[model samples]
Target: MAMNGETKTKAKSNLSKRGSKALTPFSPYIDAVNQAKSCQWSPSNEEGFFLMATAESVLSFDLVHEKIRTCREVPATVGLYGNFRGGDRLRSAIAKMMERTFMGVEVNSAHICISSGVTAVLDLFFFATCDPGDGCLIPAPYFPAFDNDMSIRNEVQPIPVQPADTHTYIPTAEEMEKAVVEAAKRGVKPRVLLITNPGNPLGTLYPEATLKELLLWAVNRGLHVLSDEIYANSKFGSSPDEFISMEKVAQNAVLENLLSAELVAEFVHTAYGMSKDFGMNGFRVGSLHTRSKDLLNFWQNMGMFAAVSNDTQHALAVMLEDENFVDSYVSENKRRLKKSYELLTTNFKTANLHFMSACAAMFCWLDLRSVLAESTFKAESELWKEILEECHIVLTPGEACHYGEPGFFRVCYASMPPNQLQVACDRLTAFIEKKRRKRKAANIS
Candidate 1:
């Protein structure tokens, strides 16, 4: 075959074969969804699937029918819309909700920017705060989406802060500081610090003092703070007063003493939404708050790239403005979450399985080293796959959540019914027992 110079170059390029990171391991929950199609596990087809990896509200969509009826009775033109294509009314409503409930410190609506949801807000943050190749400091065992969002789309480096103890699963402030210091030494100079409140995969909330110290350190380092406060409302046994927003801390006089003296107009952006707290994942409404005009303008420009849907904005506006609705929704969500926690705790205790504290959020981080320690599986990811094949139950491997540590998995309690939770736990116990027996037989031989 005749080939031109260009063709030869292309052929050589193809043969060069640059490497890319491996595709994310298949979601076990997705595998469970596929298996549910073949097995008759529950009375109704609707109830059998347990794929709840997203922070979706279990009850958020059920109220939509009622909302539809309510909206019909009101005037069609009653909806709020500002003159601009992407106005600040929706942003104002979200700020009001946060001010009244969690933060209690008032913020101007003009200072907030509305986005599709928390993910959109995060995307905007990366675009605004980070240049390509800039690093973002993220505590390990974070929400996997953050790592994916920063690394894949934004092309920013993730400086991981390793946990002090994999067994206890707590993120230490010293470790976080060390990671940032090391990154700075390596010339990455992390521009932003991302922290998930009420923690995601680990399920450990930071103490007030620890949070304040970290905020001060970031301020001294001239780093912008990105606080993902979507899980703010899920804290158990704490008054709203106990919940402190980093934005609020930056404005506090007492904490300012420990921070930089430059009066640097410390940049702090808070991301809030209804998906996790209100169980309204479909609403797709979330807002980002910041005091920096530069950051605000950056987001405002990015808003042109992707904006929240009109109907979702209206629905979220109604929910945010109504004190009664917010109160009722929050109380009901807490009740449901408490029930889920109780069911999972009881099952874990009874099965003699070890799990981290479920202080808040819908998941329990389980240490599976006991099971993996005896198995022939050389990799924890492979062990996760084996568990799914044997037990027909799904779990998120710890690595997916950015904890490189082996022998840990995240169990979401919010998706499963109490009975199903018990059944899954039982199945897990049986699987572990079988593995133990096989190991014993091998030892005897």
Candidate 2:
């Protein structure tokens, strides 16, 4: 096929920005290793010194027993290498579960394409839906990995929607709409809007009404919605009825009254995983749900290039089929999360620090302006570095999450044990006090 003169000109313009330079490869594992080396080690040489980003829950005897039983029950045929690409039976089972529990009204076995994990699903979705240099809209204070994955690895341009407030980490729908329009005007029109529901760092769960509005807006703009609902079941202080899936919202007449089914169908892609909800990070199982036949066909073609491991798919299928197990697991985790949030909130309140509202998820977004105001550290990243150096405490700086302000940090409540959480709170309070005293002494001098 011959390219038109206009198309050739646009290609040349894009190529000019590249300047014939090769892209740099990103290795997160290498980064993690270097970070670990820079940090102090305890005299005891204990592993507890470094807190993990997301740690799996300690499995109870019952859960362990169930897993053992499931392993035994898994057939020899299921273990065969041919089943390594995921079997139809396992896919069908997962699809059925999605249809029944997830409000996936029209899902079938064929609609399901198993992936190694949420990251794999995202990579596949990007491969299927976007070309290199295509635009993807990601809200600020996002999962940092996504920026690395989409922008760095996939060669996609990430148009950031900055958070309204550094503390809140909530980007308003209006702001998002404006960003999309602006991106389109810049000739980098977004093909996908990535939303991390029960948001990362901020931990705010979007109300059904808010999600509906966003969906409608995306449909109007001809943008695809990639809903990252991995934290869907981690909601604190919310009932199951309060949680709304994109599929459910799209199907609701009163909720999506303005948008027709055809419009709604085009805009939605849901990504859910067992890692966040079940605390099974090692499982690496996740699903991508979409109603668009065209999108599904594209994904199917992409799957031909790469597929998920069959063993993991079978494990996920078994887990999904056992609703009772998932319910019990979610219930216990929710209780733990609620309690952790309460403890953290109490500590922050005692220190005269405030956190933005966090209804669900593992993190609490904190405003560090009061602490920053009295410190020599001019930026949040510097403050974070100082904290690590002086207090030996580690928290994600908001700047790293794409919030430009130098007055916010994210504390992960889920990864810390109860005692560790208490110690962390004490260290934070002490750090604030120490900084205050230094400022006061300097003022006196």
Pairs with steric clashes in candidate 1? 57-279
lDDT per prediction?
0.67, 0.67
- After superposition, the stretches of candidate 2 with alpha carbons farther than 4 Å from their true spots are 1-48, 52-69, 79-86, 96-109, 165-170, 238-241, 253-257, 304-306, 373-378
Q: Pick the candidate with the highest TM-score.
A: 1
> What is the C-alpha lDDT profile of model 2 across 303-324, one tens digit per residue?
5444666666656667667777
Model 1 residue 414 distance off true place after TM-score fit, in angstroms: 0.9
State every prediction's TM-score relative to the real structure.
0.84, 0.82
**Model 1 poorest 10 in a row by lDDT:** 1-10
